[model samples]
Target: MTQVIRAYVGSLLGFLLLDALWLGFIAKDNYTQAMEGLMRDKVHIWPWIVFYTLYCMAMVYLVIRPQFNAEKASGVFIGGGVLGAAAYGAYNMTNYALLADWPLGISLQDWVWGAVVTSLSSYCGWRLARR
Candidate 1:
């Protein structure tokens, strides 16, 4: 139980920090240009709150816990990256299929970013759980 909590906390913090840096600074202009009219003028807070909460839980439970117990450090990073790819791919592909002008480049970039971010975040979770 305690380990679960630690993993969740660590994963959430790492994910949020890395994502914030990417969205708020690194790729802000790119995303703004890519999303353009699709984006809301004002940020919606609730959806993000819910997404982060549930996503962190899933990351900790599905990726971190099993890998941590198995003592496979590599598994956590690999599994997390795969999970991120699948999740982000689903969302991006869906948008590409449904939306009129979704940018393939942005989707590709997001897929890579998701994998990298989730891999590192999973490492953070595993480290905390192991302690």
Candidate 2:
């Protein structure tokens, strides 16, 4: 529906901007790369960030009815984000299984980091909804 697309697209862009800004303060180096739109090792987090944010915002927006309130959306977004993190963990396991010799360390810790990044992004999406 029109509203669904609006919320989805709006959440994604809003998160992209806010995350970049949020990271700007907490992570100056990453913020620089994000601002420049460069593809560096640091920028690798972007994919996971964007993915989780999109999933949470979209899920919340789609589920809530005609007029989505920020509070309800935030709750749903958090739930969606947690689910996304779990999904990301599973995905990493599958990916590592496919690539036995991944240059980067193939461990549960790495997978956990992926989940952290996803959770953070989802949080950002929720924050944006409230604004």
Candidate 3:
């Protein structure tokens, strides 16, 4: 139980840190704008992001690598990322369904980016576990 709790916290912290690292490095290091963006309703699914991600990861970990600990967290992250991408795709679809506007190839792009980052985060956690 302690281990699972530890795993959850460890994974969450690592995920947040990694998210910040990339957001800072490439997204012009702008939090104010991000805050503003999250505060809106058009793309205002901000509250769902954290819990949804961790939950997806947890599902992935429990299913795929129950023994890998930190490494398992990576799988969870990738799982969660895939979930996130699907969500964005779904959100766009629902909004533009009437207009018939789809993201087409952009969904692929999000998938790639999300997978890469999530994998990196999971890998970092796995390596940190050193077992």
Candidate 4:
């Protein structure tokens, strides 16, 4: 139970930090240009909180726990990337398909970001849990 909590906290922190960097600095221009008229001036806080909570829980359960149990960092990295890519791809691809103005470049960039972030976070979580 303690290990699970440690891994969850570690992964959540890692995810938040990396996502902040991506949204605030790295991909800000891309997202702004892509979302232009589609974005709200102010994002609602509750939905995002819910999303992060659920997403992190899924990551901890599906990626971090297995890697911790197996004591294999590679499992965490690979599984996390795959899971993240699939999850993000579902959202992005669906938007691209349904929304006329959804940018393909944005979707691609987000997919990459999601996979990389998930892999790194999962590794961090696994390492923290092992300690």
TM-score of each: 0.96, 0.44, 0.48, 0.96
lDDT of 4 by residue, 1-131 (tens): 99998898888889999999999999999999989989998889998788788888888999988777684588899998998999899999999999999999999999998899989988878888888
Cα lDDT of all candidates, in order? 0.90, 0.51, 0.50, 0.89
**What local lDDT score does residue 13 receive in model 2, on the 0 to 100 scale?**
62
- Misplaced by over 4 Å in model 3 are 28-53, 56-60, 63-65, 69-106, 127-131
Distance (Å) between predicted and true CA of 113, model 1? 0.9
RMSD of each: 1.0, 7.2, 6.0, 1.0
List pairs with backbone clashes in candidate 4: none
lDDT of 3 by residue, 5-124 (tens): 444555556667766675557543343343443334664557758654764365336422444543335455565456545654565445446444334343354445555555555444
lDDT of 1 at 49: 98
Residue-level lDDT of model 1, residues 53-121, one tens digit each, is 998898998899888677668999898999899888898889888999899989999989988898889
Report the C-alpha displacement of residue 16, candidate 1, in angstroms: 0.4
Choose 2 or 3, whichever is better by TM-score. Answer: 3
Give the lowest summed-lDDT range of ten residues in model 4: 65-74
